[model samples]
Target: MIEESGRVVSIEEGAVWVETLRRSTCSACSANAGCGQGLMEKLGVGQRRGYVRALTDLQLAVGDGVVIGIREDLLLRSSLQVYLLPLLGLFAGAMLAQWLALPEAFVILLALGGFFAVWWRVRGCSRRGVDDPAMQPVVLRAQLAVCAMPVEDR
Candidate 1:
């Protein structure tokens, strides 16, 4: 399970909206100095909060902290759907155009068309998966609040 800690932002009938900080490891990469991605991270390009509607049975309040998780297999499948599908579409389109002996410009255009078509299909699938319990993250448990007071004060 891939787990993340987040704070509950809102409550619904059977779920809670949790807000988590989107974290990256770009700073730890050895190529950070020469990587455009590392520079982009330095510029805060992808730093943002992520909101997830996690299904939960625990009684949660808006300020409560919780740990949420999704299955590793689900994450892997989603990754493949987002990345491999488009590449396959592009290759298929290019192969078909080449086999037909189409002009170079037409081949590029057809490839792009195929890529966009598959991307559109993937977007639709993601939308439909929004309500799928198997795809959605689940609240694993609520985080216990730490006491701010010193032990001597007790």
Candidate 2:
């Protein structure tokens, strides 16, 4: 499971809005200084705050802290869906256009058409609830003080 802790910014209809600090991998690497990512970081673009919505079982309220997790399998599937589908669509369109000996402009348009088609298909699937459950992040545990107290200490 991939997990992150965030403060509960709001709670509504069984969903919790969590605000978390976003960190970049560039900061940890030695080559950060010369890289684009590092340059952005140096320009005060690092450590931005981001928010996520998590489906929760616990009764949570605003100002609460919580831990949320995405299952590994779900994460993998989502990653593939978001990244691979577009690439596949672009390649397929390019290949078909090439086979037809289409003009350069037409080829570019076809490629973009393929990419957008896949994007639209994915959106339709999302609306149809094909991957809804797997895509949603789950609230793993409430970060209440009581829960954090060790048994021995308690």
Candidate with top lDDT is 1
lDDT value, candidate 2, whole model = 0.85
TM-score for each predicted model, relative to the true structure:
0.88, 0.82
Distance from true position, residue 102, model 1, in Å?
0.3
For 42-138, candidate 1 gives per-residue lDDT tens digits of 9999789999999999999999999999999999999999999999999888888999999999899889988999999999999998888888899
- Kindly provide the TM-score of model 2 when superposed on the true structure, using C-alpha atoms: 0.82
How much does candidate 1 score in TM-score?
0.88
Best by TM-score: 1
Clash pairs, model 2 backbone:
none
